[model samples]
Target: MIITRAKEYCIKILSSSNCKKLPFHNLSHTQEVVEHAALIAKETSIDSEETEPIIIAAWFHDTGHSKTYFGHEEVSKELANEYLTSVGYDTKKIKIVLSCIDATKMPQHPSNLHAKVLCDADLFHIGTELFFCKKLLLRREWELEKIKTYSDKEWHKINLAFLEKHKFKTDYGQTVLEDMKLKNLEKVKTILSFY
Candidate 1:
């Protein structure tokens, strides 16, 4: 029931909250990550207890974006903590959820199975057909935030670097998602050839 409430809370906070700035990390992305998190948890065959926190974490993971551009993970933790505590969630489970949220940060360092699942789920799009569409949204978001402006070629090059350096930390991600990731890499290379 808490998981359902967490999802509802995510939708409410993200939709009605001052999240206009988050083009990429908005509700859709959070929902997709939650979906992927559940799938990865089942695929990896973790216990139901462990799966619950990961799902809640996924729902709240990028919520920090509603508050700040950088360090959203910390903000997300604050939001999760506030809600979970008000609902009297277990301290241990809340810790796991916070850790999983932190694990979604870039250059992820997941110390446990729950973290690994959340991390992979957060980046799950990079290995799916949705990558190109999602990448454009992220690029637009970055440009909107004025984080860094990149020419088309420059963006492709950066994506190449990120794709090269990024490895799926979970075995299911490494094996199941790796195939499409390689294909996406090739696609990016081909697109880059035109520039």
Candidate 2:
């Protein structure tokens, strides 16, 4: 029920006034992440008592992308708080939601179960077939911002570096997601060597 309601809210929010600035951080991405979170919750030993907050956090995780502002995880948290409060979501749950969203920042080290769930779900595509598509979306987003553009080789190098340094901290993440992630990393390495 909470997931359904949050999904509805996410669709409505992305469809309304918040449509312009978010090229990639739009409703579909939110939906995908929420679905990923729910899957992780079910597949792992995570408490269902905490599922509502994680789902809510996933729904609002990128709401700040609708803003002209950049790197808006903090702004995402604020929007989540306001929206959750306005809709009479439980205050304690809202706090957990906000914290989960905030835990997705670039230098993230999620300190709790909810935060770990959000972090892993937000990155769930890293091992999927859509990994390249997600990477392109991010690159295009950077291009839109007039940030430095990356060549194919440069991008692969950067991605490889990231994969080399990154490790899944949660047991759920390690057990369920790590092998595919490593496979994806190897694929990237192959593609880079070919370039």
Candidate 2's TM-score reads 0.89
Instruction: List model 2 lDDT by residue over 21-108, tens digit each.
Output: 5566777777788888888877766788878899889988887776644677887788777777888888989888988888888767
Q: What is the lDDT of candidate 1?
A: 0.91
Lowest summed lDDT window (length 10), candidate 2: 15-24
For residue 73, model 2's alpha carbon misses the true position, in angstroms, by 1.0
Q: Where in model 2 is the C-alpha error above 4 Å?
A: 1-3, 17-23
Please report, in order, the local distance difference test score of every candidate based on alpha carbons.
Answer: 0.91, 0.80
Query: Per-residue lDDT tens digits of candidate 1, residues 68-118?
Result: 889999999999999999999999999999999998888899988899999
Q: Score residue 106 of candidate 2 by CA lDDT.
A: 70
RMSD of each: 1.2, 2.0
